[model samples]
Target: MKKKDLLKLPSVSEVLLEINDNKYHNDKYIKYIIKDEIAAFRSQAKQGSLQLDRNQIIQSILLKITKLSTASIKPVINATGIILHTGLGRAPVGKKIISKVSKRLSGYVNLELNLETGKRGQRQEHISALISSITGAEDAMVVNNNAAAVLLSLNELAEGKDVIVSRGQLVEIGGSFRIPDMITKSGCKLVEVGTTNRTHISDYEKAISSNTGLILWVHTSNYIISGFTKQVKIDELVELGRKKRIPVMSDLGCGEILDLSNKGIPTNMIVHDVIKSGSSITTFSGDKLLGGPQCGIIAGKRSLIKRIKVNPIARTVRSDKWTISLLEETLRSLRMDSINDNLTLSLMVTTRKELEKRANKLLSVIPTKLRSNHNISIQETFVEAGSGTLPGATFDSIAFKISSKKYTPAKLSDKFRNAQNPVVGYIKGNNYYIDFKSIISSQEKLLLSSIVEVLG
Candidate 1:
């Protein structure tokens, strides 16, 4: 910890001179990184853990700079098979949809222009009609995400009033976003009715008063309570709202625009059905079950939508041109009954037989050298429609069960994850598994190459 030892550390100018790469030419930024590194070295020296090698310190600084310069949001293969995995981006837009959107948006075409009138127009106009047609709502609007949609609805309709919600339906979604918190943020009071396991219509009736701004019915999309659980339905709430002359809002967390029961997926209330149930306003996520880009869709009575659009917060959370364009095409695909062209739905509806074929194909292509060195076999597994869309429902899937005496499961998984194109898999018991359910066909070659590179 002596001053003489600290002076051995390289100066900022010395380190900058060593960094010859032109891409790291931001001298001010590089100097800041160098100063931060030097401070850390001094701290380590005081703690008696400093490595005195000047070359090593400079290399460490270079590595930090390189890491900071690289983009952290690059795409990685989702090998864990959790379709709609939140960490991997909940919904995957189809290539055709992306191609069509790129053609229109790569340049510009009527983002907010009334070409005929030769004046400025609203961006929501691009997708509002499409959403109205698909969902049967009198009118609709798009926002940045579902949370914002719910926030905007509550703020516009129930600010300074009580928003009644069932205790059972007051669930927390990803990143600790809770229903009660959202209501409070929207300038409304959260009124909890009935018990966590049971909420009767009478509970709602007793809670309503002159101060009740809106009756909120939240869908427990992420979790379920069964056996002795009772909750009010949308239609029942709608009837009560009509009798009481109060607006009822339903937050269908993962909104379904199509009936997926035929695809072996569980059925939920499609947006049209929710609108038909007579709710005043309904908010749902565009990314989850809708198989669209990340956005929140608010569809309901035309009058209510009009008020929501006028709220200043609406502009703050509004969807941009790119989101509108992508969502419009996604809705069109749904309208045309082209499920195969929707990546999220296609992946959800991928048959067990198809997954088996994909698994076998991958196994067949593994080099003989890798096969001899590792125990690679196909095994049956299950993956969920993640992001809280279908709780308690798991689809049948197949995975490559890889085991090796030379490498532990953790080591094998790490190696795959750090490859040129990272492959993410799960380790269970003593083996590492890569489920083929979520891996698209186009990624098969890359997956094969990663496996060979790691095991060879």
Candidate 2:
């Protein structure tokens, strides 16, 4: 097989036919997939040490095509105990409710049309009532994510004007996405008020001017400033916004509904009681603490919401009907008092007794030989609700620190990580902990079985 001839890939249409035998991609999607795959192949072969046959190249292409064709947005168990693992497609929706979304997604039914009046109605109407009632926002608009919500607000309301943010709150995330960068992109001037460690009400007060269009209070969502730190309170900031006659726009980046402290859960309480607070707007994610979809929700005064609705940027950043429809369903579930039962976050934060039950369930299937003379015991351990939600917060969770007879802690941990369903865990002082809080109920047996299989 000539290398050049081998490199000449099959027609994407032909490959598509081989994979599905019925469904075919539209010309544009086919072109994009093939172009991208071919580009990747060429880049990989640039080292010149690699050789590709026509069949091998075709196999590679077919694998990608098949993966895409049968894509169903499947669920994966979060064994890392990061309750809101943003990277692993944050917030897998509840099975039953997401099933509803999937069914409706296959066909369009009145996305914008008002069924009752036989006229056009705002798509935002679907979620408006639920979001307002739930979050106590007089009005709300949801976009792709929290960042987009923040961007949309700034672009619409503070464009070509000064937006004052705390130097303390000007934090960066995974991709070097900075608060200043977002503010700059929104056509707003970034004014840093206080130092990263400590920022006071006086710092914000000193920066206000006619150009100061928005007093941006971005939460230190992921990172925390420890001792010797002082920050403005949400209510105090709302008061400052009132005195300055400027809108206070806050980004509660992580999502939460019920106060963690009130729930007797060891998590921080930072969500501004915004519905009752006389503030212009507040934004937060639907996934993090809310345990909902990855959506950015903006809720605040009706007047400010009206302005945001009319903004040109909204069209670009606003979510589709599927997102709103699913969110509405989730919100409706909450209104009906079904959210606590259905929510993953609630399921994850288990009592010590509940944790013991789950651990014992897994232990039942754990192989005898590796169970340290068959006397393996479940012990209580501190499990942090992860992915930057609560830094120091610890929840009582149960896990088996497999005191093994056969394998070392590191070896056992590695085995589970490579399983069909990855069971991520950590070890310290020769103890391996598979936190019950992280693994799903269905996954418990699988985890135990995996350990047995590895030992066997």
Candidate 3:
């Protein structure tokens, strides 16, 4: 506690040697971590902000080292009912997709090689046919994400020209990405054509000029604009583009390939439907509705796709083999008509009865006494498809509400997050909720253990 005692703390060399005995592979990294912890403790001692006995110095150093060891990116359970939670890594992939992608990671196997001709091949060729077949497009290519795809399309088609877009569709979503900003960055002039809530086809007709290079229709998937709203349809825009000889493009931000209308969840323009609507090009995110890795898919007519593919920006925003492999596997599963498929998005859109069953099963795993500790109950809840998809739409789900007498909602949330595999949930007022919409059946046991550990 005294200055003299602080001066007698373990030397850096001694602490480094002690840590070296723990079998740390990198001596330099361990030595740096040990020295940094010691400096902080010494600073605190000088300022009288804290006191540490000489005997506790080694233990403190060990704790700091242990904390650093576990500070890597590890997987956590998602109980937040947000199927596409951006902060928690948008969509979850199955083990089969993981294994298939893992195989492509080690060494190499025809990543850019054509097996039939035994020559160098294009990387996009691997998934191009699958995407075209699934989306009914003449051709398709991929970029790193939807943003990149938009940038590439705009730069390649409308550079130094006019891009007509609706004022309502000039949206800014997560990560500060705005349509006007992207248009400016693409070296194109943005010609706003419609009002915020309404844009008639005549607006586009008036905006068209000799400089009009592209017509962009952005699907406001992140938020809803309703009540006296009128936007030009893709078919109408495509008809106009056909007459004017200008390319029509649609940005289906969270485009889905499957039809979920039967599940009571209304979906917007599907990728294939947009392609069939005669848009010259359509772009969407692979991670959101497709339930694949983070990538951007651009599908449309063969001529437009060919032009976009040869653009120099396409090479910079292209997807790597890891994304390509997982995407290929995901598309294959979607194409199959099997009933026992394990798609992540499909599971998130499961029926209310199925979610209630999963919730009850999770509750049954927790012992009766532990359940009573927090006064847990199975409550009907609603959750959104997070990360800017289906903004105002919420799906029916089951949530286990816990009201702890010993701890408030905040304290209980902290406890759940401190688990080995952290559990994320939602809290409203004084109650903490773990929704069953995003929690898979295999995670029920782990969720039960985390709940019991927190409340018991």
Best by TM-score: 3
Minimum summed lDDT over a 10-residue window in model 2 is located at 334-343
Give candidate 1 regions above 4 Å deviation: 2-7, 20-30, 46-48
List, residue by residue over 193-309, the lDDT tens digit for candidate 2: 888788899998999998999988877777878989888877788899888898898887776676556444554553447546665888888877777777899998899999999
TM-score of 1: 0.94
* Comparing 2 and 3 on TM-score, the stronger one: 3
Per residue, candidate 1 scores C-alpha lDDT tens digits across 337-395 of 45888998899889889999988977987987787678899999988889998788889
Candidate 3: list runs displaced more than 4 Å.
1-9, 20-23
Pairwise lDDT winner, candidates 2 and 3: 3
**TM-scores of the candidates in the order shown:** 0.94, 0.82, 0.94
Superposed on all Cα atoms, model 2 deviates from the true structure by an RMSD in Å of 4.7
Candidate 2 regions exceeding 4 Å error are 1-74, 260-262, 270-272, 335-340, 370-379, 402-418, 426-432, 452-455
In candidate 3, position 99 carries an lDDT of 79
**Across residues 331-412, which tens digit of lDDT does each residue of candidate 3 receive?**
8887434423445666665888998887887788788987887788999888888888877988888888988888999988
